[model samples]
Target chain A: MSDNQKKLIEMIVGMQSPEAIELTKVMLEEGADPNTILDICRKAMDSVGQKFEAGEYFVPELILAGDMLERISELVKPLLKEGGGGQKKTHGKVLIGTVAGDLHDIGKNIVTFMLDVNGFEVKDIGIDVPVATFIKEIQDFQPAVVGLSGFLTLAYDAMKETVEAIKTAGLRDNMKIMIGGGQVDQVICDYTGADGFGLNAMHAVKFCKEWFGVKE
Target chain B: MNTATQPTSNNELYAERVQRLNDAIALRQPDRVPIIMNSLFWHTRHAGLSFRDAMYDYDGLSAATRKALDELQPDAYVLPHPIMALGPTMDIMGYRQLKWPGHDGVSNDVPFQYLDKEYMKADEYADYIFDPTGFMLHKYLPRIATAFEPLAKLPNFPSLYYTRIIHSTRSFANPDLVNAFQTLQKAGEEMGRMLGKTVQFIDDMAALGYPLAESATALSPYDLFADYFRGSKGIMLDMFMRKDLLLEAMDKAAKLIPLQAIPAAKHSRSKGVFIPLHWPGDGLMSPDQFKTFYWPPLRKVVMTLIENGLTPIMFWEGGCTSRLEHIMDIPPGKCVYFFERTDIFKAKEVLGKLVCLRGNVPGTVMSAGNPDDIKAYCKKLIEVAGKGGGFIMDGGSGIPDESKDENVQAMFDATREYGGYA
Candidate 1:
């Protein structure tokens, strides 16, 4: 990363959305490598995630960072066709959601943002997602991993039912299933028949990497 | 279910249990460890009644509750707040946040789900802090319930004050506003009657020897703001972007709650005030955030209640691993802290001498683990948390509404088997 590129990374990490957006546009207009820009955005997001974990930042910052990246992606995608640098070829695709009857999406949203920055193609089926949608998305998206997110105890039965439905439909063989939520534990994982549980969003990145045997 | 123990005619058994529980709260060793449960609509489901039944049939539901409590005979049980049980009025109010059984899309067995959306807008923090009651009357109520929608049209306060003084009839001249006031009055009367009956039922239960664990309930100011008002996404952003305003709102809420709660909880059986603490756990915020946002105002509330001779049962929702040390700031034997996901044993170790530790074996174990597993789990909770007479046996969270009878029965059975202090 060049001096200007490093400056852009710091701006993104600082959550200076307008400054970062303007810098990316200027850097690109002056012909900075799109790969470096993409790389720096990823690193900046990582910094935001770390701050969130450390309690220096919070949900609003995470939401803002996600928005910044989305805006930056729109700007950088057109210029990176030759370098193929705008979209890091997804290491793996993952389908994720908070299961039926659960309205909490904070944890799931954070994981989705984390996965996006870490270069995984994530399909968030959104909160209160039913089993049918999970199956449809699994078949449609062909994700390597499936994440069931729930914050309530009732979602336990829903998760177990969804996992069982997938097994009955013969889709379980194709994807690795993971459950993430505040209440989920090893016992909950076994009860829901999911392969593992993610303690937090960053833990999710480590889980995906461990599953695919890849390095970020 | 064993519906056999009714506390002998002199009410000795009931007194023994109440004394036992109160003793534990006072940091004195009782005959044995007492179990205090939130119950959390589990009893409604346990008796084969739907959550809908609890809302509609007070007599039948109270009978069901009486029957269930007679069987398990917890040292004492936390009664459900009757305000949430008024099905028709709540539905008619078009309360956007709560999904009740039968009337809402929710199934019969499921309890009411509190859906947190943005009721208080991000821009309204100043209004909320400056005049909360005024804001709640003219600004907040309209946004929260459809029944109060007409009030939203009332000009902002001071303007409305002047209008009320100048053209008193103008307030009622708007036919829609008149209709709204009538709806509000009628609904208030009906709700008051229903809530009155519920309070009567609780008194009757107390007369029958089963005292309530928490007669008064207060939502922590932080949660009141984060949950019902700004929501996690909104308030959290405010925390980063507008820290002072958020804290101001929280402090105002903390001071205002006692006005609604303390006077109303004057029932003879009302002992401890219940404050459910959410969003302070390690999962939601870090230690520093918790110290800054949650502890100070809530602690002040607890101390005030204590000075006024009320025990405060502070239930820690989610987990409290990050903020356990801060929990120790309270005076010894001054309060009871019910933990959901916090390590109860570690809590006992940390704040055992300071506050009584109640709870929390994971609620899932009842349905997911075997009866023996629950017994073992309860035994472990008793062994670790029951030391020095500061622990009560109960679910980490409330019992899941779907937990089986045998699993829940194990809670009492394990208490008898392994929880005896004598």
Candidate 2:
């Protein structure tokens, strides 16, 4: 990587928003490949994920880093389209949303952002999503992984209902289903009939990556 | 030596309950480990009241809460007042912070959901710091509540000293501003009625021989800023970008909270100040960030409360395992450290001698698991954390709304069976 590109990654990881955005603009002005720059941003996010897992970083750092990546991607997108490299490759597709009866979306939003930055095509159907909407979106999006998120205990019944609906529709076998957010455990997972459960955003990412057979 | 044998009078029962809780708070063994039922919506549900009815009808709320307390019969119970239900008060003021049941397309059974957003922008810190009262009157209140929107048009009132007072007073005559003031008056009256009901409920519950766990609540200044003004994302970013301004705002809030919390606590039936911690847990912010930004201002508020002889009951909401050591700086036996998800065993080991430990039976068990699950967990909590006293049996985050009726009964039964002291 060029020195500017490396510095851009460092700034992004450090959560220096203006410095990272300015550096991205400078790198683009210097005629760096937009695809290479995007890849470098992903590389920085990988380091950020590692730091978070290692306890060196926390939610604030992750949020700031994600924000920087988003701003940097906005700067790089037009350039990619002009260079005829608009269609990007993703590891796999992941569909995530907060289940019905639960309006909480912070955890789901964080997981969605993490998945997007980690090179997955993430479709966030938004919060308080009905089970029928999930089924409709799944048929249309045809994702490899589906994540159900809810923070309230009442959402356990909602999750079970959704999971059962998914099974009745014969859509369970094709995709790996994972449930998360708010006190999810083996009992909840079994009750919801999800394949597995994740305690945090990184766990959700790891499950998606593992199911897709992608090694980080 | 316990009230289970039937006290001669309700006053004796009340005194016994008070002593039991005080002994636990002082890190001494009472007759038994006091059990407090901290369930919110579960109370309404147990009484067969819809969430909407509980919020709107004060009589229904009081009856429902009374039914639950009479059936459960714990040492202490969180008053199921309409303060949280926001019944008529929500519509009176046009409050914009939360979406509640029976309003704005929400179903009658749903709980109120707080809509978290930055009510105050990043650039408005200077405005807030210079005059928080003026800032609230001018900017913050207007943004959060529609009724106060016209107050934004009124000139800064602090400048209205001499002839300026006459000039400023005229602005209140504006039809819109007049309407706003009248609406505020109605809101105040509604709040008065709600509080009256709450006081009556407390008295009725106390008459029936139950004590309130907390008389008043104080919000951590950091949480006040994070929840109402800056929002979680905005405040988190502020820690990195505008650390000094954030610190200044929190320092200002430290002084403001005790002004209300102390006086309210003094007038109430209990001496505990319930402070529910919204942020500053292990995964949300690093230990260093928590130490630098979150803890100091909070510690200031806590210390002030302790100095005033009121015990501060801090409900640490999330997993704060890393924050255990940092929080031990408080004076011993002067506070209750209630953990929602923190490792209570570790908390007991670290803070047992210093502070009373309450809670951490998983809400998942209370909600989904059977009575056996609750009994075994409570048995273990009573044996371990309840050893030598200073532990109160409670759910990790109170009993969940969907918690099984049998499981809640099991929790109460387990406390009596396993929580006695020699």
Using lDDT, give the best candidate's number: 2
* Cα TM-score per model: 0.91, 0.97
State how far residue B406 of model 2 sits from its true place (Å): 0.2
lDDT of 1 by residue, B365-406 (tens): 876777988888888887888876877778887677667788
Cα lDDT of model 1 by residue, A1-216, tens digit? 578888988887887778888998999999987777888888888788778767687555676688678889889888876649655546789889999878888889889988888778888889989889888888888888999998888888999999999998898886788998888888889999999897678778778888977775
Query: Which 10 consecutive residues of model 1 chain B have the lowest summed lDDT?
Result: B1-10
Mind listing the fnat for each candidate? 0.27, 0.62
TM for candidate 1 is 0.91
TM-score of 2: 0.97
TM-score for the A chain of candidate 2? 0.92
The top-ranked prediction according to TM-score is 2
Q: Write the per-residue lDDT of candidate 2 for residues B1-422, one digit (tens) a residue.
A: 24466678888888888998999999999889898988778888888988888888888888888888888888888766735657798799998998888888889998777887888898888888899999998888899888989988888877778888877778878999999999999999988898888888899889989899898889888899899999888898898888899999889999999999999999989999999998967788898999988899999999999999899999998788999999889888899999988999988999999999999888878877899989899988988999999998899988888889999999999888878886
**Which one wins on DockQ?**
2
TM-score of only chain B in every candidate structure: 0.93, 0.97
